[model samples]
Target: MPAAPTAAWSLAEWLAWQEQLHPKSIELGLERVRSVALRLGLLPARAVTLTIAGTNGKGSSSTLAASIYREAGYRTGLYTSPHLQRYNERVAIDGVQASDADLCHAFLAIEQARGATPLTYFEFGTLAALWLFREADVRVQVLEVGLGGRLDAVNIVDADAALITNIGLDHTDWLGDDRESIGREKAGVLRQGCPAVLVERHPPESVLAVAEDLQVPLLRLGRDYDFSPRDAAWRWQGPSGALDELPLPALPGAMQLQNASGVLALVETLRGKLPVTPAAIAAALRSLQLPGRLQRVGACLLDVGHNAEAAEVLAEHLRSLRPAGRVLLVLGMLADKPVEAFARLLQPLVSRAFLGGLPGARGLDAPVLQARLRSLGMETEACRDIPEALRRALAQAAPEDLVVVTGSFVTVAAALDVLHE
Candidate 1:
């Protein structure tokens, strides 16, 4: 729901337009966007799309797939949601963003195409990403679900290969209250007679049930594809074949190895159609980069682990490092999430807190965060925003101390911006 004059606005101004269009920030279900998409002729791209859905690993899977395909010399497009800093990061081709002019053109195109239908912020953005990908004629497009997969705007395209990374109780309010219910919601993107990869180490039965009922060729981890680490290297085995020797992924987390493994399984699943060479696979594995996943700056660590599930992986990585001094956490989170679980996971790992406000409407107030810290018996400092929080951490931290920014993407994003500067 862009402004009436979106055609006259810049990308930022148009984004502002979209913000006002939807009364609610996030509307879960795909009916409205799907109908608009059908009217706009977007369903055919469904035949060529590989939609990846999950709470934590959707971004990682989409990027990994896009990189592998592009390194193999295929023109590839990658789309992920809730960009950290810039809006353009949500859409890319061959690792570069869709230009501002192109995005503006897309905004105009979607505005024209929507007619009387109202689209959510994510829905409009999804349509724009699809529009850009179709116009550019990329060989393959890797699309990440904005929310639960089944009725998301991205589901309008029937996925050629749908990868459900894992099910978690995220967005429980909209999808359902448990893993089984959430898993069923995520299972919505699977298309019949196509390859569907289940990357979960332990998948819920709901996901498996949907796959069986849909009649898609299911490739399950440990069953259809498997991999392991040995002597600073790893091995992969898939339905098409095996890679006995491979470089460990450069993505900077233990979780990413399994993610890359799934991508290889998918490539193998579509071998003849996609045709990725060993060298390309190796190159993509070596060069793939994600900024905020366990990144380090001098005396500071930053990650975008916003949920308890993600925090577990972050916690393991932190434990391995065993920083000399206690961790000082700079925290912020969205109001809707389970703040208690996120805080609980990091409490033992954290020694104190520098509570701060994140940069959006959904962010938790610094005072509320400070209260949480006090309840845990942790020392607390307050700051206006991320830069001030980091400045405080830098001054207060011993050279041996580790400052971790957690709680949400908004928190990590602010820390990442300062670290880069």
Candidate 2:
């Protein structure tokens, strides 16, 4: 085995070392991670745990849940994956990103405990977050599953409540090919007798079967819980009661309502232990901020929507906005994603596309994306990278036009760096 990182090592050095520590970057199984957690005594976290799993809205839903708990005066921890800018974004306490010194300490602890066992980059991060959360003495922890829930590193903790925020066809290679198989994998987060919330009105049978077989107290949207528009505000009705005149979520898009409703249901299940008031819910919705989800900066909008489902939602949101001028797109995607299908979904709304090359082995090149868009009969320009794409798109866009930056998280991160500069 390679030498472990020392206490003096920086967070960036530790992260770089971890990326090459394991044989496979993404070997999805619990045995290795669970064993490490046992050694670290991170199992059975003292805090109330809410594990969120889904292809699309896991980030938004997890953020919403954690914000509500924090607003209710709890020291909350949130762990999410594929961060846009920095590694620190993965583990947050009370809405603040974990500090480099804290993360380095956590990494050292895990390094000393793991002996000869090898851990993937993601596994190391997950264990580190759990250790930090435990040390912080958080009252609640919201864990967003890194991949399919069954064996995702975050699933090591049997959560008090599990929320599946509408599964779709994503990570098909690792999870499965179809929605049924994907749903089954996501459903693995649900524990027996624990409450599970489903945001999808008509979830796949596989998800429902797992809940039924486990005898999970399921709260499903449109059945057990639902949301409706009330003027500029909205109302959420769940098994417990109704929360009326709630402010629309600060997160844009109609899909946020679906995510908010499921979060409300999950919050209701934990009321006995957490006890979040209606005011906290309203406050959280009005103030919560999630980066790169239709996030607007002047005339440019940035979203990390890489798949067909996300594309559909983005298209819907764009239509609702009704931009006075054409919608210009800057897109970069991983090689594994369904670029053609994703592009087709937004083809009608997009007047022109500026394609760019993403980094890493999985990132698709700009020329490849150009060919895909051309096949769809859409006008396209291929840029060397996302920053160039954003620049060219912005330079060409009229004042009334909306410039959209999207595809993978990496794409949006690059655009954000340029915008900040």
Candidate 3:
């Protein structure tokens, strides 16, 4: 077995070491993680737990729920994956990321407990987050599934409530080929008798079947709960109650209302354990801010949306904005994503496409993306990296025009680093 990480190691060093400990980056199964979690006493989480799983809106939904709980005077612990900026962003307490010392301590504990068992990077992070939450004695915990729900490391914790925000064709290689098959995998987060909130307007039959088989009380958007635009605001009505004149979520995009509505539903389901007032709900909506989800830095908008479904939503938002000059796109994506479909959906809205090569083994090259966009009759330029692509796009963009940086988290992170610099 590889030598155990030293207690003196920094958070960065521990993370780097953990990455190399596992042979495969992603091995979707709960046995190994569950064993380690059991040893750490993380099962049957002491806090009221909410687990969110979906293709597009998991980050937004989980953040909204955690914000609401925080507003309600609860000590909230939130854990999300693939952070845009730092690894610490993956674990938070009351909207504050865990400190380096805190994360390192948790890692040490897990290392000692695991002995010789190997754990994936995500598995290690999940265990660390749970350990920190437990140690902090948090009142509520919001966990976002990293990938598919069933086998995802976060699933080890049976949440008090589960929220599945719309399913789409993403990670098809691991999840499934079609929406139906993927829906089933996402629905695995739901436990029997536990209430589940589904934001999908037209949910697949497989999802419904899982809820039925599990005897889960499913609250679906448009049917069991929904929201509508008021004159200047919006209104959300769910099984528990309705909140009117609700300020729109601070997060951009019309689809956020759907995510917020589902978060409210999840909040309502856990009302018995962690009661939240309508005031807290409204306050949370107005205050929540997630980076890289249609985030605007100066005239450039950065969104970490890579799937075709997300691209479609992005197209609508761009149309609604209707910049006087033109929309320029700086995009980079992983090789496994549906690059052609994503480009095709956004082609009409985009005036010019600047394709940037992403880093790492899974990253697609800029030349490849340029070729795909050119074949679709879209004007394109290829750049060596996202920062280069952003710089070129910004130079070409007029004062009234908007430059959008999107495709993947890594893509947006690169743009953000340069923009902030």
Please name the candidate that would achieve the greatest lDDT relative to the true structure: 2
**Model 1 lDDT-worst window of ten:** 1-10
Local accuracy by lDDT, each model = 0.83, 0.93, 0.92
Q: Compute the lDDT of residue 238 as modeled in candidate 1.
A: 88
Model 3 stretches with alpha carbons more than 4 Å out: 1-3
lDDT of 1: 0.83
TM-score of each: 0.95, 0.98, 0.98
**Cα error, candidate 1, residue 310 (Å):** 0.7
lDDT of 3: 0.92
lDDT of 3 by residue, 90-113 (tens): 999999999999999999999999
Local accuracy of candidate 2 as per-residue lDDT tens digits, 113-186: 99888999999999999999999999999999999999899999999999998778889999999999999999
Candidate 2 segments exceeding 4 Å error: 1-3
Error of 2 at 235 (Å): 0.9
